[model samples]
Target: MARKVYGISGMHCASCAAIIEKRLTAIEGVRHAEVNFATEKATVELDSRAPSLDSINDRLRPLGYLLLDETHDQGAAESETAHQATPKEREEAKELRKNRNTVRLALPSAILMVALMLYGMLFRPLPHTLYNPLAMILATIILFGPGRTFLRGVASFLRYGAATMDTLVGLGTATAYGYSAAITLFPPVRDFLGAGTHTYFDTTIIVIGFVLSGKYLESRSKTRTGETIEKLIGLQTKSALLVRDGKETLVDVSEVRRGSLLRVKPGAVIPVDGIIAAGDGTIDESAVSGEPVPVDKGPGDSVTGGTINRRGSFTFTAMQVGSKTMLSRIIAMVEEAQGSRAPIQNLADRVAAVFVPVVLVLALLDLLLWLTLGTRFMGFTEALPLALNSFIAILVIACPCALGLATPTAIIVGVGRGAENGILIRNAEALEKLAVADTVVFDKTGTVTTGRPAVTDIVALDTGTAASRILQLAASVERLSEHPLAGAIVEAAERDGTELLECSQFRSEEGLGVSALVEGREVRVRKPTAGESARPEAAALLEEGKTVAVLEREGRAIAILALADTIKENARSAVEALKRQGIQTVMITGDRAETAEHIAREAGIDTVISGVLPAGKAERIANLQQEGRTVAMVGDGINDAPALAVADAGIAMATGTDIAIAAAGVTILKGDVGKVPLAIGLSRATLRVVKRNLFWAFFYNILAIPLAGGAFYPIFGLLLHPALAGTAMAGSSLSVVASSLWLKRMKIG
Candidate 1:
């Protein structure tokens, strides 16, 4: 299957989006389609040999909408430079002007309609010559001018069998105007009905007035939702100073090639992803990592594009430019994530799919039932106009716009909030999954404890050499190895400024240790097995949660080196937070029982599973699942990939291996253990908002539909006016949007 995103035009409400989504999904070879009303974009997944763009557009043209190609707006949409007006910005500006014009037209129509309704009901009715022509002129201008889009939508619906909110509004207003115009133009029709019966001129104009004003407010609020992406793009610097052979030349950031040295001064954003080649500086990486603290960057340290250098100057060799840069990748990830539909949204889509058709059927039945029964039970003079008013009110009030706006609006705001707090929620499903996970399993090495291990204990078995000399010899042999423990030993030696002898014929034993000829003596460093004559000091170190290595020279035990990893500062606090939320925390590791327990205890984990190999990790996660626990695994290495994939929600630290990140569902940008609970909290909060929005959207329609159908007339002697019904429909959609907007102010982190 292949997936693509296309810009859609002429979506007025959620019902319009639903119509497009349904039609697109019905196409042959198309697997799924999601149309987001707020974003005004449709994401479609289809077979490789699916329909062509022309065919897709052919299906949509009759629906009064257009699909724009991905590359159509090259300069505006795809440009990395952010200072220029983007395609989205241009669209928003145009919408603002259109809204102003709509309001200007709608206000006059509304005032005229109010005066006409009051004159007919409160006092004596005006003559047809005076009131009919004035109402006719105002209603026509409102319907054809500010309300032209709905008329076009209705025309498209008639031709293409497409039904939407626009169709309902247009049909309702047109019926009122057509009936009223007939009564005005022909004096016989007015006399045939009754002397007191007045034209329904106010209903036509007032409905259009409510719709235009509602659309203006909806458009403005929708524009604010895309500000997150705009702000992120704004962080990119437009130009950089390229350094070549001691000469610097200014160039666009996009023009900087990989491996080109770029000079960055203090107070300037890093132009691209690169490694520090010279000098040192403090870089503020909050834009990408959400870490407020400034990070120190020196030679060999990586600096991401869009980060600001706070102090000192530096020269960095660009490693990733353009779209491959870290900031660009983040923006792309967020866009895709925001566009994805959650499973919860399916319910709303399914409801919206049938909502418009059902509403149309009910509206027709309402008119037929009332006209047939009301004419005999009451009288034609009193019943016909009331039946007509009832039909118009039913059609105007039943809007699928609220249903369509329910989930996507909340998801967009929730996901955008997550991004703001250094949490990269991969998709809507992951966000939903994280909310319900009951158990969280942490990989010990890089998750609970800091992955970096340091030499904690050194013991000399015999008097062959001093402690410093023993460390030097061990470091010399270990330098040839790439294991984490080996690196620790090498680092300890370097930190102490110890002189190391050269090693030759270096060889490493898998899962055991390294061997080398150091100072012309065969030296070996290996983990002690069962019954090995390890010193009491080494055993003590192991008991204290340190990994001990036995070093021997010339068949004699010479020294022992013990290295231990320290727990993260925030791990315990994060675990405690999860516990408070009624979530169980477990630590899984391949370390010795004592070592694992020590780390787990420090991290406040309730359960510890130690001595588990790489393959056993997934099995352990599966066992937890069998126990009915919704597991969330957190890891940052290749070995943890299987476990990450097996769990309900896999959270990967951004600093970990690429495989780990690929296996995980969520990635914490700064690799902070505390973000684990933060992600879950945000998910739960977002889901709550989604449920609330869905509930209100459904409830609003259910209650409003019945009332608009004149269900309350028999008991309360009340009928919903078409103008009031239109106002209620507008309010329902705006209420859902407003509730979703509340998520932006939530304190997720």
Candidate 2:
């Protein structure tokens, strides 16, 4: 299957997304469709032989929507997005202008209607021949000039059979305008219904004016939410000093290809990701890593694009240019993460899917109830006007905008903040899961320690050769192995100027030790395992809190190489932080029980599970989960891949193996264990924001919908006007968006 993201044009609410997703998924060859209302995009998975774009567009045209293929001339699309004003900016500007124009046209009519209402209340009503025609003319201008958009939307709904915010607005406003026009033209029909009846031309103008003002505010607020991505893109310099044919020439950043040598000056941003070929400089990589400190760079060090060369000038061979640069990848990842939907969003989507149709039904019922039964309670003369006002209010006030905006707005803000802090959350689901992890399982080496062990002690027994000879022989055999402990033994031998003899017939036991033929004798080094033959000397060294590797000659133990790895500076504090949050921290290692316990104690871990082979790590995680714990495994090695995959959330350190990073859900660059708690803290904050948004959205509807339906009119003599309903509905959506944007201000410690 092939997956692609297509830009959608007419997604106004979450219900529109549901309709698009349902329709797209129903097509042949399309496996799945995920439509995001916040991003206005649809990610679709389809078989190799996919349906035609025309077919997809044909299905959407009736709904007054467009699905743009993102894969067409990506270079052109990027250039169009970056060089010129973005599509979003253009659309928002257009909306703002349109809203301002509508307000300009509607304000005069609204003023006239208010003056007419006040004149009637204070003095005798104006004659229908004079004031009624004036009101009808003003209303016609307002309806056609400022309210034409809603009218066009209604036309689409009638022709296409799709309902949206436009459907509700167009129906409500058209009803008020049409009723008033009838009352003005046919006075006898109005007199038969009620003697003191008046046309509602003011309501039509006020409703459109208020709804336009809300949309203008909403468009402005949404534009601010995209500043994170904008700032990131702005860091890339448009031009670069390209060194071609041994002569320097300034060229567009896009013109610089891979293998091109680019000269970066002090204070200038690097044009592309590359290796330093000549000169050295202090590079400020705060834009990419979020670390404010400048880093020293020398020849052969890799430099990323968009980082400023703070102090000296350098020439670099561009390795990854254009979209392949690290900066581009980061932007793309952030975009994907922001567009993703969490499991919690499913409830919001389900509610939004049926919200419009249900609101329509409720509005109809409100009108029917008032028309039939309202006369008995209120009076026959007031029933028609009350029912008309209630129907209009119910239609205009009941909006699904808040419900659709709740989840995606929060997710977009959360993902952008995480990217700025050097945490690349893969998806919304991973960030959501991180908030619930209670048990944190860590790999002992590289994760909790420095991962670089030194040979601290070497003890020789049985007068065969000097301790130096034992070290040389052990180093010779261990040099063939790539383990960290093996490097420690070899480094010790090399420091002592011991000549190592070549080893042959080498064999390594996974988690146990290694054996090889050194100097025509069988030499073996092993960390003692349970139920395995061991020496008393090895036990003594193990009890001393050292990683002991015993050497044997002809299957007899001879010497012990005791190594110790230094604990990381932040390991203890990271463990303490987790413990303070009531999270249990466990260290799983392949070393002996005594060594594992010692390291655990030094790192402030409460539990130590030791003597487990590399392959059995996942089993240990499963056993822990059996005790009803949500386990999050942090590891930085190939051996930890299985355990990482088995845990509820796998956090991979950037210093770790490629397989471990691939298996993990969250990857923390620079391998800082302290960031684990920070990720959790950020997740909790984002989850809190999401919950608050959902609750407020539901609560607003629950309270506003009933009031709009005139549920309190019988007892309180109150009725929510359609204009106020429009204002309240607009405020509800704006409030949800404002709440989501507030996540950026959170300081996750």
Which is the leading candidate under TM-score? 1
The candidate scoring highest on lDDT is 1
Which TM-score value belongs to model 2? 0.83
Tens-place lDDT per residue, model 2, 8-103, is 776666778988998899888899999988777789998976788788889888776777765524553332223445444455466578777777
lDDT per residue (tens digit) for residues 1-749 in model 1: 88888877778877788888888988998899888877788898889768898899898887777776654233333325445654445655777788778888896778777776787689987776787798889888888888787788678778877888888998899899889988888879878876344777788899989877887888777766666777788898888899988999998766788999999998988988999999999999887788899999899999999899999999999998777787887787777777778889889888887888799899999888788887788877887788888889988999888888888788788878777778887888888888999999999987888889988777887876788988888899999999988998999999999877888999999998889998788999998765453557766777878888888888777787888998888999999999988899999999989999888877889999999999999999999999999999999999999999999999999889989988988999868999999899888988998899899999988998888888788789899999999889888888988988899887663
- Which ranges of candidate 1 are over 4 A from the true structure? 26-31, 46-52, 72-96, 115-129, 455-540, 548-562
Clashes by residue pair, model 2: none
lDDT of each: 0.85, 0.83
Give the lDDT of residue 690 in candidate 2.
Answer: 92
Worst 10 residues of 2 by lDDT: 76-85
